[model samples]
Target: MSRTSGATTSPGAALAALAGAQFTVMLATSIVNVALPQIRAGVGLSDSGTTWVVNAYGLAFGALLLAGGRAADLLGRRTVLLAGLALFGVSSVAAGLASSSGILITARAVQGLGAAAIAPAALALVMDLFPPGPGRGRALGVWGAVSGAGGAAGVLLGGVLTQALSWPWIFYAVATGAFLVLAAAAAFVTTTPVRESGRFDVLGTATVTLALTALVWGLTTARRSGWTDPQVLGAFAAAAGMTAAFVLIERRHPNPLLPPRLFAAGRVTAGNVLMALLGSVWIALFFFLPLHQQQVLGSSPLLTGLGQLPLAAANMLGSTLAPRISRRIGATATVTGALLTEAAGLLWLSQISAHGSYLADILGPSILIGLGLSTAFVQLTALSVEGVARQDSGLAGGLVNTTRQVGGAIGLAVLATLAGTVTAHAATHQPHLEALTAGYRAAFGISAAVLAATALLAAALTRRGSTPTAGEPVPAGPASTAARAN
Candidate 1:
């Protein structure tokens, strides 16, 4: 590590390393999607148990992210990041080697815990390296690109690995990457001074964690049991109660896990809200698109994976171009337009039918949706961290990620349930393929509506934030992070 750089060895190298860490976690998330059946068969998991393997990771990861973010601030980011990587590595190994469903599920939960730690810390460290400036803004493009690539790449890589080798290889490959990232972080990321000023907010932490866990559990459970189920209702009730409790505790506590100031920041608030909508779209697209292709179009797993390449490529392109485009058009307008484009693309996709094929029906919309989502994502990441105290960076990062994951989970469950109902009713009179396509199209229509709503919100909420001048560098300040027209 070099003292001259103020962060670690080389800032670019450190960013790459951190990006790699972020990629590893995001990749792990989707990699399991294609391999779920293989894993289920291999471990003799029941259908519900198989779903648990995925949900268990998401539940723990989404729930603990806030605490993990705060821990990065209280403990050292470098220290916590290293700890997270270590836990992820060990858990991945355990998951890879597990012979029973219970063991794999447990290991995945641990892996999720590790992810909760890594995500916030890595984003904070990126801020630590680049600061709020031209370099930092541009770096966000690369960061977003890596994240976008990770999700799409996971689907492709997961399919390839599962077909060529086995399901366990996905875990093994990621574990190896985790270890490599751990080594890089230790070598390249500098040790920062930990914030030791405040008393720990145990009550606030507990209430918030429990609230989030309950909420995510409730939403996820709704996919299996109907929304009216007693357990689902109870979980929602618990979440609401805990959330209220958390608010009260935060007010009274000397130090809060999430300071009230963040909520007061309009840019931060809007950024998070948009990210949540974006998350919902991301999950729904990934989940339902393949089903439409495979179930309706009779595409194989390999063809389905290949069909996503243009989307993956377009995503990378959108992310790479985001920073430059924002400089010209303003981040706010850029995001709004991009989101509108995505909604249009999704609306086009909603017209899919039994006559549709991959090239005819899927390619254009996939690329358009990819371009819009990736572009919006890059800008949103920058928007979320605007005007925050350096000390609260991890908290902001954690909050953004938490909202996205949790929001996506909730939205997916609702959309899937709705689509399922529509499919069941439609199937009585039509072929199953037509019915399934109708359900998938309904999901796409709903997603488009959500994206349209998001664009309107972005256009409205960001009005109160800073509006950077076009064609000139906006100096880093409390107001620079807000996207504005003109």
Candidate 2:
């Protein structure tokens, strides 16, 4: 059998290349937030239309993730990574050059497709680079740090680029970074022998992708048309039907994109469940936070980006500290504590006022939310892949990411819709700024409730002591790799 031991190149170079690819994938998700106003003005998009610019990428990325993971196992990890980078680079440039809303949204979706491929393949490569030991643990820590930091850093970069140059420069910058990573990867990352052989589950992929698309569309459309609107109902119905079909297809497929057996582990299920909740809050936080800064506080894009620095620092610090904390406490306590901390922070954030200052209203909560969110993300990620068999590591990686992205997409849609509804109702008597603040407050409040509930569920559902202790490295391969894939 071909060696499944490690990367052929120097481990450091390979890890950097893999991590860089993952960072770019995450950066694309949040970098557009601070520039949304410019993008809307430049493309003449409606508020609802602008939401699609964000949703389209997330939808595609979440939908295609399982397929991408499977492809990496069957085709080749390095080949898939390279192809994803090229596509991502090209599409980002296309997005940057687009003159119309349709073109930009389409480019963003294509970028998502590339991201779908990049994320799984790069993560799998990290697994291939190191065995399940301290080397792998340290590598995964770096991955977690970058993953957590990427979102905050994106907003900062987006602000600088959008203010200094233009909104399009954000895409241009991503393209530049992607191409640079592609080059580095080509030079340093070696091809791994294809470990699994199976034909693509085309029907399963189609049904699941369509199901996710329909669900997101239903949620997003509900904001404009009332929840009971026939169109919204139809979208939801279609989503349900497609989801049922996908589940049935998975049951029979000789090579299912997502194996039903993977859900048997309580830890995996609880980890993913909480991940969805966390993702919903994570994605919406970025979306609403910047808008609140710009719209309510009257901060400039650059100022909004700079304001994210504290949150970014806190996130990095949390990620750095999570494994150590997990070592001192168990993963269960660590994760639960993190969730409660996040919920408290979100609750604090829900009190945002039209006249509030950044220092008083945003800064403390940003730090709290950032630290809690990052810590929870790292621990849950480790929990998610705690017991999977070696052969299924790649699929587990994809599944965890899929849950996070899909949850974010759906969560953002839900929160945005709720906020919009609240704002509309409040607008009858309140000033526009106050109305907007009311909406944001409602979203944050709901997010806090969801997180608190998630914490309770996570505590109840996770098997106590099943997770690795802090001293014991979170397994990345035979029951481990999916942890860092987050």
Per-candidate Cα RMSD to the true structure, in Å, reads 3.9, 2.9
Residue-pair clashes per candidate, as listed? 0, 4
Q: Relative to the true structure, how large is the alpha-carbon lDDT of every model?
A: 0.80, 0.85
Model 2 steric clash pairs? 327-470, 475-480, 476-480, 476-481
For model 2, what is the error of residue 36's alpha carbon versus the real structure, in angstroms, after optimal superposition?
Answer: 0.9
Q: Each model's TM-score, in the order given? A: 0.91, 0.95
lDDT of the structure predicted as candidate 1: 0.80
Off by over 4 Å in 1: 1-6, 44-51, 469-486
Question: How would you encode candidate 2's per-residue C-alpha lDDT over 371-396 as one tens digit per residue?
Answer: 89988887787667656554555666
Lowest summed lDDT across 10 adjacent residues in model 2 is found at 477-486
Error of 1 at 165 (Å): 1.2
Worst 10 residues of 1 by lDDT: 477-486
